[model samples]
Target: MNVRPTLEEIRRAPKVLLHDHLDGGVRPGTVADLARESGYPDLPTTDADNLREWFEAAADSGSLERYLETFSHTVGVMQSVEALTRVAYECAEDLANDGIVYAEVRYAPEQHLRDGLSLEQVVEAVLDGFERGGREFGIRVGTLVTAMRHQARSMEIAELAVRYRDAGVVGFDIAGAEAGYPPTRHLDAFEYLQRENAHFTIHAGEGFGLPSIWQAIQWCGADRLGHGVRIIDDIKVDGDRARLGRLADYVRDKRIPLEMCPTSNVQTGAAKSIAEHPIGLLRRLSFRVTVNTDNRLMSGTSLSEEFAKLVEVFGYGWDDLQWFTVNAMKSAFAPFTDRLELINGVIKPGFAQLKWSGTRPLA
Candidate 1:
């Protein structure tokens, strides 16, 4: 039988988050404060605790349409450049506190343009905020310019991301309902990003199926998959053994990372529950699986909380968490040198302390 590590031990483990949404991870109090500053008074709940519960319940409704409605409330207040900057800064500070050595926070610029903020202005403001927070908290953060899949401006958003590639924007992505608005629909955008030699991750198989996952990788040329928990559906498990499909074989062989968010997957109905998630199976199969909190406020989780849940459900130990953290660092779009620096400087030392504590390493 596998042994579950204590919460204290898991909390001390180093972590990397490759898939987090900036607006989705906003603190409820920050949203309330921003709402007050912006004079937007239509929030379902005014109190921070109540507002958080409200977001979680809405997102857990099992309907992607209703789940997306919660974002409108959070993004509604994040209109002005000041609001964006503050929220972005707070996200970095919070992630650092969660012990995430490296993270890539994604947000759609078009969603933040309702208040007359240009795409360029929004990108610059967010970068400024991340830089300030990084200096204050001493964590490495990058931005992934996201384009909404249902929207027709994906090509434009992709270009904007590549245009600002050197200005803190690390990659590109397409998020939103993944069923009808498939990645194939945004081929132009993906094609443009490829031509510019830019990297991108796609949201697939969260609310959809293997076809969505296939198209995102085979058709759209994605470097990583966002909420790709459904890739497990392609694997044929026979008792203690499992077989992989052609697509799964390709993904595993190429080491295309799958950004799996456990709590969020359960809350969003992607996974039935934490115990049922395929993270452990995928990890054992050597699929470059990295854990993340898709939305902290909505899932009521941090990186530590995620690590803790994995321990409770799958009996993960310090070594398992370390492997996941390193997988995330390897999957990050950060430059090779920067990635190595984080691994050597932050991740290695943190795990070394844990190893020296005499916890039995996973065999």
Candidate 2:
């Protein structure tokens, strides 16, 4: 007989995160404190608990646009160098405490320039914070500098990513509403990154359909798909048999990583519910499916919480959790040697203990 793993057990599992956002995962209390120090009085509530509830409720409006509105408050407070560094440092500490041994946190450098900070300064501050936090928390953190798809600074952001490639910055990304602002609009950035042999992922297939995903992959050549929940649209299930569309076949055949954020997908209406998410089918089909928390604060989730929910809904066990963790580590933008080191040294060893403990069955 197999027993369900406890929350504490799940929390102790070594995890790898590849799709977290720095601005969207700010601590609620930190938001209030930053707002007060910045003299920004537009917060709905200064009470940390109330603010948290507000963010979750606001993000649950079942519309991606409305869901994104919650970021205004968070991004508003992250203009200065001190605020950016604090948010990044705390992000590392929080994920480390959540048992995430490695994470690649993304944020738009352009969004934090309101206080007249240069793009270089914005990147430097975040890298410094991640360095400090990683040293203190014993967690490895990599930064991905993102560009807003709705805006036209992607090329510039890509340059910044390359400039800091030897630093803490790992990759470039284009993230925003996927409907009107297609990934093709930022071809210059993707082309630039490709020319320089840099890595990049595009936000696609979440709020949009197969076309969005098709363009991101075939057109923009994304290294991974961010919140690619709509990849389900390209897969048709007939009883026990499943058929994949051309795009879906290509995605699966190529083993492109889908950074699926189950809770955040539901909050943004990309997924109807956790039980009905495409990740289950995708995983079973051997797609390169990696679990993530697109926005922890808004979704009120951590990587551990994400795995725990999957366990409850899909009856996942140590083997399943290890699969997703290894997928993420393999798909990470870091060097192949680094990825291999973490997989063998940290992730596998950590899960091996849990596996032999008889907490749950492999299946």
Candidate 3:
């Protein structure tokens, strides 16, 4: 039998994160410091501990407005170039310390225009931070430039992504509420990216249903689905077997990656709880699923903690974790050669060592 790995042991394994938000993972202490320095006095409490508790509590509040208010404060403090660069640097450092071998962090450039920084300035600042942090921390960092789906600036953002494609900007994305603003609303942007041969993912099927995901893939040509929890709705399961609908079949057959965020899903009522999450069924059904920390600060989770929760709920061992890591690495926006190098070089070796260590005492 495969021994279930402990959280600490899981933390030591090499992981690949494909979906993380740059602003969503800001450190509370850093948020507090930035707020103080920027004189952005809208924080509920400048006390880091209290601010942390507030964010945690607010996510669980089940109010959309309150949940969004959290980002407003984080974005409020992150107006200047220095603030953006520092947050990106610390984001890379924190992920590296948590044993992430590779990650692609994303943020919207339009949101940071309040402080007179040009869109190019915002992208440059973030890229500079990731470069410095990756060098010092021994992790590879790539960036995804995100455009809010509700806004009409996606064409500009898509152009921005292609503009900086060679300079650590690996991909593009569209994010925001999925209710009134559909992914197809930004079809021109997606089509533009497709024409440029640029990779992009769309926020879909989290707060909305099948049509959102359908359009994101079929219409917008999304390379991946962000928070694609509702894809579960298309599958009907009997005790031992599940039937995939046309859309679900297409998603699986094409190997489209679903970036699943468990705790965040529960917080937003997408999933009832971690145990009841669709990931278990999706993993069993062999869908291309990749685990992610959608918002580390808001979800109160890391990539390791996300895997540990899967272990506790589904009884996953090192092999299961390795499968998820490999899936994420394969689904990454980086080149095939680079992805293969990490899979064969860092990830496989790290998992092999951990599997051995995790079972040796029993032997």
**TM-score, every prediction:** 0.96, 0.98, 0.98
lDDT per residue (tens digit) for residues 23-64 in model 3: 889999999999999999889998998888888888776544
| Candidate 3 residue spans exceeding 4 A from truth | 63-65, 360-363
Give the Cα lDDT of each candidate.
Answer: 0.88, 0.93, 0.91
Q: Is candidate 1 or candidate 3 better by lDDT?
A: 3
Off by over 4 Å in 2: 1-3, 359-363
| Displacement of the residue 258 alpha carbon in candidate 3, Å | 0.4
What pairs collide in candidate 3?
none
| Model 2 TM-score, all chains together | 0.98
How many clashing residue pairs are found in candidate 1? 0
- The TM-score of candidate 1 is 0.96
**For model 1, which pairs clash?**
none
